[model samples]
Structures are given as structure tokens and as C-alpha cells.
Target: MERIRLTGAQATMLATLYGKAMDARSPNSVLHDTMALEAVRRIDHDFSKVGIKPGDASTVALRSLHFDGWTREFLAAHPEATVLHLGCGLDTRVFRVDPGPGVRWFDVDYPDVIDLRRKVFPEREGDYTLLATPVTPAGWLAQVPADRPVLVVAEGLTMYLREEAGRELFRAIVERFPSGQLVFDGFSKRGIKLQKVNKAVQVAGATLYWGVDGPAELESIHPALRCVSAVSAFDLDGFDRVRLAYRLLAKAARMIPVMRRMAIMYRLEF
Candidate 1:
């Protein structure tokens, strides 16, 4: 089995990877990412240390599914568009979305995380590239073709960066692409302040910094950027599939405006 030695926010990817793996193993798998399941088997780490319960598995898978759905929608319209998946970690989205040969897919992350990805995941064929670099203000953006429409997706990545860095990252993507969409999950300020109670944060000893109460906050990053859609976490596709306790939590989250904003998925068009 492959041993994991990642630390900080990078290390949190393992818990999500394992959560998706557990979801794939379940009878009512939300994302059905069998590749995630396989990756977990190849890794030597004891995932139990992360404390990913069945509810967490469902939550992770559901988030992935929502992002997958958005990607599918974009690809169906522009099959040849370039896909920029920032902070990719160990996610198998390239496999999950399975875009056409014309769609160039780039998975960006730190060098060590990319190295771990290469070890656990199989080599993908046709128009797929793994970029080993931090996404923020990096020259790595030069590697992506600027002509085609771009679909930028960042899952479980925001809030890790300071607000300035996060806004700059958003500014960079909107400025780089002529036309396309950016989809990501964001937490509210209260959520970031209350993050110490989060299991994954405890496991990885990670830090949270940026937070936005709404998509309007993201729009200020670039003049061309426009809010397309904003969906709360509990309102995602597989809400019913999650256990009742999680469903109740979602219902409760809905009542509190800040809590509702705490787990929002936003899509913006430029």
C-alpha cells in the first residue's frame, strides 16, 4: 500500500478521498466514484483517524456530485473547452466527468499532492494534464490555452486562503479566460470562525481564512464576473439520499441565514 505523508490543508484531502471511497462502497452511493474507492485501497494510511463517518461520506459525495453536474452541463455546451480544476488534491474528477478528447483537463495542486495523485491514480488517456503548482498567482496559468472557453472548478478549496489571495485567484481566472464559468463552494465568516469543531480540520490541523456571505462578494473580484447561480449545500442533488440526521441538520442550517450561507455552492459566468 502507498503511504501518505501530507500535512496541513493538503493532508485533509485524504479524509475527503477516504470519505468518497466509503460513499462508493455504500449501497446508495451519491457520487459512485469507484476510482476513489480504489485509490483508498492503494493508500496505506488508517483513514479512521480522520473520523469520516457515514454522514461525512454522504456529504463529500454529494458535494462532488453537485460539482460533477455543473461540469457536465458546461461540457455538454462546449465539449472542447479547457477544464481547470484548482486545488485538485486526490480527486478523480477527470475520471468522473470523463470529458471528450477535445476537452483539455488540467488538475492543479502542490507538487507533493500531485506526486501522491500519480501514485494512487492510473494514467488517464487523451487531453489530460496534471499541473504540479499552487493555483494562486502562479505562472502555471500560462500552461493553459487561453483561446478556448474555460470551466474552472474548485471543490473544498476556498476558505483555506486569506481573503486577498482568494480574491486575487478569482480575479486571475476571470481575467485569463475570455468566456466560461467558475464553480466553487464557499463558507461564511461565522463558519470559518466555528471551524475548530470540524473533524477534517482537526485531523489535518488545517486553517481557514476567507469567507463570503454570498456570490455578490465574489462578483467584486472582476467586473466581467457575474453570478449565475447560488445553491445551498442541503439543496444539492443527493439531499434525500443522505441519512435523516444529516437531513435534519440541513433543515436546521436553512433556518439560520449565516448557517445557510456557510455551505453555499456558487457558479459565476464571465
Candidate 2:
């Protein structure tokens, strides 16, 4: 089979589908919930036309929802705060969160993704801008106003970065903005090792290169960095219709703690 350059929307579609596949039984799970699932279904249909198979499609979909939930929660409290979504892909978070009139939102990604996004979504005049540039390069920070409070979110992008680069990115955000918050998903060291053996991960072009054993690991990156919360699918609350087996597994993972090595979202305040 020939290799295809998957667009950001295509990758996001896969992440959403993966979440739906894993938690299809949980009515409260984002994948099992409302409009987001419908969006995922639409993306999956598009992926099918492009010859993307079900398994790969689902993995990306799950990852998208996982980050989407975290991003939505953070934006809820800081609606007025500026939101910088790194490696945003084609996720409709700005619409999902609906920052209203005052909040400033910037979606940063590679040029190709931005190009496609403009065509796919309507361009609103105020409160949003699509930035087409590599996030790692310097000078992009100047574009954002340092006066307002900021929240930087990195969803599925961190795992692809090396440890030093990730740390530098964290430091840069803290240094650039006077005060803000960050929420990003990270894998544990064991998770990194396991990915090497997981054929499923290999097929998706994913590798768990960055890992944080616990909150302290994130805090150690900078003294100003404070871990407000760490969450896993198992830690999520408010599910009325969870299955017995799944509930048991989630509870067991929390009790053991070691099971958190799989994947956890870290919320940091600076």
C-alpha cells in the first residue's frame, strides 16, 4: 500500500473514533455523548473514502476526545483567558467550548492543516485566528499579547517530541505568559516501553517518547510549575450507566495506581 500524508482533520477523526470504540458502552463518556460523536462519525465516513481502515481511525478519535474533554473543562473556568491550542489539528474545540465574545483563541499548526481548516470552517472576524507556522520556532510568541491570562493546551502532540524539547516548550510558555495554565496528556515510562511491543501502536505511526511517572516529574521541570490535577479515564466521575466490568476496571486502576502508567492528563498551573 502507498503511504499517504494524513491531514490534521483525518488524524483527529481517527482519535475521536478510537474513543468511541473504547467507551461505546458509557453513556456519559464524551465518545458516547452528543454532537462530538456525530462529528466523529462524519469524520470516519470521510476517512473511509480515503481508504483509512477502522482500527487506525479509532485510535486517533479516542485521543482527540480525551484531549477535548480536558480542554473544554479548562476553558469553562477561564472563558476570558486566551487559549493557545498547539498542534490543534481539525478538532472543533472553539465551537465546542464557545468562548463567547471576549475570549481570544489561537489555533497553531503546520501550514497544510491551517490551509485545510480555512476551507472546512467559516472564518469569523473576531476572537479567533488560524496561525500557520511551526510552533517550535521562536518569534511566534510575540504574536500573542502578554497582557492577558493564557492557557496553553497540547493534546496529542507532546508524545512525538523529545524529552528536552518538551521541557523547553513548557519553560517557554511559562516565560512568555505572565500567568496561565497548561493541560496536556502524557504517557508513563512503562507506557513508552509497552508501545514498542504493541503492534497496534506501530501501525498508527505513534511512539510514546515522553513520559512522566507522576506529578512531581512535571513540577520538577520548573519551580513555578504546579500540578493542579492528574486524571485518567478511570478517574473520571459522574457516569450513571457504566457497565459492571468497566467500572470495576476503572476502580481497580485507581486503587493500584500502577495502571495509571497507561495514559494520564496533567493539569498544571503557573
Candidate 3:
């Protein structure tokens, strides 16, 4: 099969898929995304350029674990809630979670990406909907059900967006829903700098434009939003010299706010 060529931002989704696939193959993996593993095998692109070393793949697996756990909890609490997965690339989350009959799940991304997803992924079951549109402060949200609680997940996305764009997106989401939860990851300025040279990012031609130190600053982006919790990549369970470094950095970041910017898993409520 001919390989699909994607824009840098679009290709970042491939990076996460690679991570999930690699993790699934690991013996004691945090995320067992068999779907992701399959997707990686089906796609005919050179994944090595994503510069995902063993440590980096482990980090990606941990991040996937965090998002998966968070979403499961949310669905358990609000079985009938609407789930809006923004910038959802080729991720097989819907199949993995299987939110059942009551939940309304939406997977959204660029029109081209969604088209590719439809071809590669299995047909949707139940109340699953796919929206192909740019995720911004515009037409897309109007189509979503506003009355029910919303669980929004934006993975491997914000770093490519400008600060104002990120602010506008969250603000729009908060404004549309009566109440809900938003889970995403944010990197610090230093991390953005590192991404420029990252093999995968460079190969994908994606650029990192934004970073934040903590959830408090993001809370300022929208009045209704409040920080619930924030965890560092190092705070997750793992044993490695790099993981130890992250653990130590996470602890130190608590003392020094700037250090907190390294990488964060944030849960916010409105």
C-alpha cells in the first residue's frame, strides 16, 4: 500500500501511535493499545525519524496510561456524558474505552486526517460521531450537545498551537458546556526548544509554539475553568535513570515553579 503523507501537525498523531504501539509490545507496558500497534503496522511511513528512543517511548506510554485512566474514570462517573476528543488523529481510543450505548463519543480532527481514519479504522458502533474540522473557537462546538457533561481530551496537540489559540479553544469549550472535565498535557518552553531538534518532529515538519508552567495560568484563560490536579511525567511509575531524573525534577519543580514547566498532565474542571 502507498504511504499516507501528512502535514507536520497531522503527523504528530503518528508519533503518539508509534509510542502506543511500542508500549503495547513491551512486556510490562502501561498502555496495552493493541489497536495502536495494528495501526502502526498498517501505516507505511518511516517512524524512526520521530526520534522516539526507549526512554521517550516509555514517556509516551505513561502519558497514554494517564489519559486512558482519566477517561475511564470520567465515563464511570458520567456514563451518559458526551465525550469530545479533539485533535484525535489515528488514535483508537473509542475502541479501547468502549463507552457503551449511553455515551455519545466524537472524534474530531482535520478533514483529511478524519478521512484517513475512516479508511484505516473499523466502522463506528453505537453513538460514535466523527467531525472533520479545525479545532478552534468556531463552528464545530455548535454541533455538540451542550446540555450533558462533556469529557474533552486533547493529546499531542497544544504544543503545536500558539498560546492565544490554546486559550481560545479552552474558553470555547468551557463556554459551550454547562460543566465538564478537560484533560491534556502541556510542555515547558525548554521542552518546546527540544522538539525543534526532535527527529520525529523534524521529520514530520511540526513546530512547537506554546508552553505553560502550571494549571493556574491556564485557569486564567477561562473564568469557568479551575485546576483539579497536575502530575509530572516523572511522577508516573517507572524505573530508569531518565525517569529518576524526571522524578527528582518533578519534586524540585514543586519548590521552584519554573521547573514545573518541564511536562505536565493536567485535569481541569469547570
Q: Which candidate is the best by TM-score?
A: 1
lDDT of model 3 at residue 91? Answer: 86
For 1-270, candidate 2 gives per-residue lDDT tens digits of: 112355432244344433444344343443443443444444323433332343333334455555666666666776677889987766666765667676899999878767756655557667898889877754687898877778888876676667887888888888888888888888788777776655434545555577778899899989999998788746654322345655567677777777855778788999
Q: Model 1 RMSD to the real structure?
A: 1.0
Better candidate by TM-score, 1 or 2: 1
| Model 3 C-alpha lDDT per residue in residues 24-43, reported as the tens digit of each score | 88776777888888877777
Alpha-carbon runs more than 4 Å astray in model 1:
none
Candidate 2 TM-score, true structure as reference: 0.76
Predictions in order: lDDT: 0.89, 0.66, 0.81
> Ten-residue segment with the worst summed lDDT in candidate 1?
135-144
**Candidate no. 1 TM-score:** 0.97
lDDT of 2 at 88: 76
TM-score order of candidates, top first: 1, 3, 2
Ranking of models by lDDT = 1, 3, 2
Q: Which candidate has the top score in lDDT? A: 1
* Candidate 2, residue 171: how far the Cα is off, in Å: 0.5
User: How do the residues 75-173 of candidate 1 rate in per-residue lDDT, one tens digit apiece?
Assistant: 999988999999999999999888998899999999999999899888999989999999876567878889899999999999798899888888877
- Deviation (Å) of 195 in candidate 2: 1.6
